[model samples]
Target: MVLNLGLLLRIPVAIGFLFFTIKASGQQRYFAEKPSISFFSDGLVEDITAANQKVTSIFDALNGEIAFLMNVKDFQFANKLMQTHFNEKYMESETYPKSSFQGKVTGFNANSSGTQQVKAVGKLTIHGVTREIDVPGTIEVNGGKLKLKAKFLVKLEDYKIVVPQVVWDKIAQQVEVTLDFAYRPL
Candidate 1:
């Protein structure tokens, strides 16, 4: 049996094409390292604040795609009783254990090596309710690393988070959420 020269010549070209295709389709991915998320509520009776450091995020610099995930129960409050109540009574964390956001980053320049103001336009899911939102944030790029910071207000009623009459004076109708994420290349 003899091998055809034409067929053998086409093998290298086919392999090269396959490699290029794979490389082109593989977008750059960045994973957050120790992301921080927090929220604060100022009410007539008292102020409440909580934070969650165990958050996960993935960012695609090339296409401006980003996503975030965190367990609802991970938020920690200064008052343990408040934390418990937040999870059970307010958030219903047992039924909706996680919160997430998925969307694209607008007004971002991937090639720029400085801080750029951007907006994440996407769906935010919390307490089993999803709503489309546009969140303004800043992305700082230095030495090939990325850090994202943003603060936005979330209306409890939008997500069906009910504040009982007994606690109306203690809980605010809206809460300010802040997040900071440092991402490393994946």
Candidate 2:
């Protein structure tokens, strides 16, 4: 069979038009300027709190897609020994150096200029364990800037974080996690 010149010419034209349409849709991407995450655990013997400010995050305004990646060892604690234990024993940061979440935001409106309650449905991975979770949060858009805030609880058993028997009274079963991120257009 012989190739048709007219059909071959139309194929390239169709591909070009598809790319133009996608480009005209204006997919807005935002990058986090300073992302912060903190966790608190109240135990029988002691209360622990730690914060990490080196989290990286991205958001897509067009599709409501959001993602975050953070180093497990970046968390800072008031007690140095506790921090060491967190990285070595609980999180095993050497094996799983990074924790991440990838998901989409539900009920997000790009045109809204004020804070709106939204839910993120995604997979959260911690200590090498991945779980699908729905987290409630707020999105505030003001003066061309975007801010995200959320507070949620995490169960140690769910993430497979094993605590030593000796520190049973020092660690809690559930920990409260908080996130605050300010984003700028990319």
TM-score of each: 0.85, 0.85
Q: Candidate 1 residues 99-176, lDDT tens each? A: 888788988887898999999998899999999999999999988789999999999999999999988877889999
Residue 101 of model 1 has an lDDT of 87
lDDT of each: 0.82, 0.82
Candidate 1 backbone collisions, by pair: none
Would you list the clashing residue pairs of candidate 2?
A: none
The root-mean-square deviation over C-alpha atoms between each candidate and the true structure, in angstroms, is 11.2, 10.1
Tens digit per residue, CA lDDT, model 2, 1-186: 222222322344446335333443545667779899999999887799999998877677777778777899999999999899899999999998888888889888889899999999888999989999999999999988899999999999999999899987678989999989998876
Cα distance off (Å), candidate 1, residue 128: 0.3
